[model samples]
Target chain A: MNIVKLGYKNIADRPLSTLLSLLLLTLGVGMIALLLQVNRHIQQQMENNIRGVDMVVGAKGSPLQLILSAVYHIDAPTGNISLHEAEQLRKNRLVAAGIPLSYGDSYKGYRIVGTDHQYPELYKAPVSNGRLWQEPFEVTIGATIAQNLGLQIGDTFMGTHGMGEGSEIHDEHPYQVVGILGYANAVIDQLILTATESVWEVHHHEEEKSENHPGEENHAHEEADEKHSETTAHDGTPGEEREITAMLIRFRSPMAMIQLPRMVNENTNMQAAVPAYEINRLFNLLGVGVDTLSTIALVIMAVSGLSVFISLYNALKDQQYEMALMRTYGATRWQLVWLVLQEGLLLAGLGFLLGILFSRVGLLLISGLMEARYHYSFSGGEIIREEWQLLVASLVIGLLASLLPAVRAFKINISKTLAYD
Target chain B: MLITRSLTFSYDHRATFQFPDISLEAGTDLLILGKSGIGKTTLLHLMAGLLSPGTGHVELMGTELQTLSPAKLDRFRGRHIGLVFQRPHFIRSLSLQENLALVQYLAGKRQDKARSQQVLESLDITHKRYDRPHLLSQGEQQRATIAMAVLNNPQLILADEPTSSLDDTNCLNVASLLKQQAATTGAQLVVITHDHRLKAHFQNSILL
Candidate 1:
């Protein structure tokens, strides 16, 4: 009865053409939407995990690897730095807070981080039950580990000798869960936290057993006495000869930005990695990939717009009689023009809606695969603010594509058309 | 009532048509008969304000259509003039009832569902009220077209070649329907056609 109804009928009359145009539009929109979501998720993950830790200092190696391992907990650590050297950097006037991490063991693929209370504090993670680890063998599990491993308070598990699932078991020492941290949605959610002495004690005990007893299990009674003495020695003592994987540093002022990394790189054997710089470089690398994908998506969108134009222009020729008929029904030139434009908009609107749904479905599939591969969780239901710009872009494409066809409809010679009919 | 004076049209200055001045009172039928290419369709378009003549004034219900701006002229034509083409065409997406409703809407009249139903009933096509135009038979579509034309109850109705494609019985049926519907609405009806069979149907007849 109205232009919209007529437009819808016109589209329905050409299902194949409509579907082709819609498919192109959906793919283009879906790609852009997927890119936006992924870029936002990566940016959020990187920013949230960094959490005000200004620099990472570790044994000289890839600085990015140090930040990724010690800060993000997603890569291998850049060897170990002496605790004496770590303490020296912590005492610097430019350093506000220094959180040391010793990572050499794992519990079911989840890294067991040996650190003080500042590790959880840096990520604003609080204990949901019990308390922070206070002793060598007492451990606090992050929320995800506790849920995945189903380890409640008072449950005990022995650590593995390496930082991954398959490694030599350190059965000489057992770690008990003293607390479970609340979910902080950061890297800390996937870690198990313990005091720095736990990692050292586990390895140190292994070294003692290897040197003194050489795989003698019957010496368990003698081992208990040795552990009892070692525990007393661990209390209130800085094991200066021990080494930690890395130290997370916060600058006391902006002056440390220029002075601290330069001082560490030149004067010490440790390498200082600025998180902001590393993350920026990482984003630039990722941006190139995303930009190329988005450009391809935009080209697809442009092609779809052209398809809409061609479909409408071709349909206009076939519907010239119909246009003349409408004029006979007293439709004005503007109404005829609106009819074509509405057809274009209807196509775009449907394509945009289906495209968004397609993107969300794709995100759901991608999220599942990513979680299985990387153990990094990405939620799929977020609607980014940038999608509004995509909406406007689609509408403009629809409008522009329909322009000539609508004008053709406007200038249709009603008398001549009907005369031939 | 409808009146046209000094109506003339030329196509690209190659062919010209000088139409006979015509007049008709309310509730009457006039047939302008012509063979092919004698400007019969052009004359109907001019009266419907779909086209402007080379020289003339078409006064329908006391308004000179050519004097109005294109927008106003379109609005005026919608409000006061009803057109029925030989090949009946409806917005194919709309149902029979919706097609009638659209006529009233485009004419800037209040949409009265009851009035549309009554018009379809008078045309005896009310049984197909919700059916799409394409689903209707040829005769039913023609009646639906008449329903659209008379839906607005305009003072004047111009039908272009209403029975040119019909057999004798259908031709007579359509002509009587136009006359009967115009009488029922109290509107002047002008039907242009090349069909010689319709000449006996209208008392006021002219040859172009």
Candidate 2:
């Protein structure tokens, strides 16, 4: 009996046109919603991982790669840096803590990061069970590694020669899992951590045995017996021969932000990359792609708005008799206008809701693919605060699209329309 | 009561209409006779306040419609006048009873389902109450149109060609139903149509 009911029925009277407009609106809004969720989650993860580390010191290469390799553990290191020279830079008065990373191997695609206890402390990843690695070849698995590989406290696995899964297995040196770190939303959650000496010792033993008996079968078993004897006298100390992939540095004070990166880049052989600068550059490069996608989505939204306007205008032309009849029954012209406008709002409102649901399903599918490919988890169920702004924008589009049609309804000639019947 | 004085209207000044002055007391019936294209529907629209006259005032129950603002005129028309068009144009989505209920609602009255049912019963279309407007026969739709006109118990009921397309029997039935509903509601009835068959039905008639 209300105008809303009348409006709803009028919309229902033309199901095909309504469905077409709704489909267009849903596609536009769904694309925008999907982009918002994905971009927010990526930005959040990047910000979370780059919290403690102020700068990364690694072999000279793309500074962005240095941050991605050291902070995110997602890219290859630029090259190796001398551990003794790196230690000298770490001793600068401005340095708070400098944790070295030496990773040349992985077990089933999970990188084995060789570092000190300060590495775990930086990410606040406490051992949930058992204890941290205290000796070479004794490793600590991250929460994701343990859950994925079914590695318990006493499980033992041999590292591969390269970072990927299909490299040569270092059977001469087996790493025993001494602890499993708790879940932390940082790079540590996907890494296998151990003392830097373990990386050096495994490579040193393999080099010596290969040189002594080249291409001999079963030499790895013999080399395992010699692993203890090949350990350096100063086991955990960084020496001339020892090298690391990168060093993650935190500043002692804000003064370090200005002087430290410049000093290391100019004076030392290592290149110092500021994490914030590299990540900003990376997001700027990514922003272009995301902005292009958003523009396309906006264009689609504009097209849908046109469709809504066209359909409403056509419906007004078709329903002139009905409108005149309503006027004859005591409905004001403005009431007729409101009826048309309400139909537009109802269509947009329903389309927005359906678009949000469509985006959620799209996010679920994208998250599943991301998890399978990158081992990165994105809980897409988190609500974006910007969606409310999107809702308001959608309503504005609805309102604007119906404005002309509503005015046409307001100016209808009731006498002429009724006379035509 | 209803009265008008020298009502006139034109579109583009090509065919101007100067309507005759008339008055009707409460609870009485009047038939306005005119040939097709003689401004009969336009006159009905003018009386219902759907169209404003170019030169005169339509006064219903002592309120001059032309003097009121468009908004106030609409409210005045809703509360005090009822209109029925040539074709029965109920909100096609609603059933017969709901259409009458909608009439009351649009007139700013509380929806009384019982009153709608009573109106339907009085018109002997209570069996078609729950049916959509398109589902009803021509005679039933006309009765339902009358039911809507009387839903607000308005002071003046204006029907524009309410029986133009009906046969002899159906036309007689629709005219009687309009008069019966108008008399029962104590409203002055005005039926404007070109059908000469209705000339014998009303005591007060005007020809154009």
Error of 2 at A78 (Å): 2.5
lDDT of 2 by residue, A1-421 (tens): 8999888877887899999999989999999999999888888889888888999999888899888877887776777788888899889899998999887578888888889999989889989989999999999989988998899999999998655565568888899999999988776888999998898888777766666787753544343322111222233544865778899999999999999999989998899999999999998999999999999999998998898899999988888887877776668888999998998898888888988988899988987786666667776465678888878888888899999999999998877888777
**What TM-score would chain A of each candidate receive against the reference chain A?**
0.91, 0.91
- Candidate 2 ranges beyond 4 A from true positions: A146-151, A216-238, A254-259, A266-268, A380-382, B12-15, B93-98, B124-131, B135-137
Residue pairs with colliding backbones in model 2 are none
Residues A25-117 of candidate 1: C-alpha lDDT, one tens digit per residue: 999998998888877887888899887899999989887777887888777676778888889999999999999888857788787888999
Best by DockQ: 2
Proportion of native contacts present in model 2: 0.62
Residue A15 error, candidate 2, Å: 2.0
Off by over 4 Å in 1: A208-240, A379-382
Candidate 1, residues B66-91: lDDT per residue as tens digits? Answer: 99887677778777778888888876
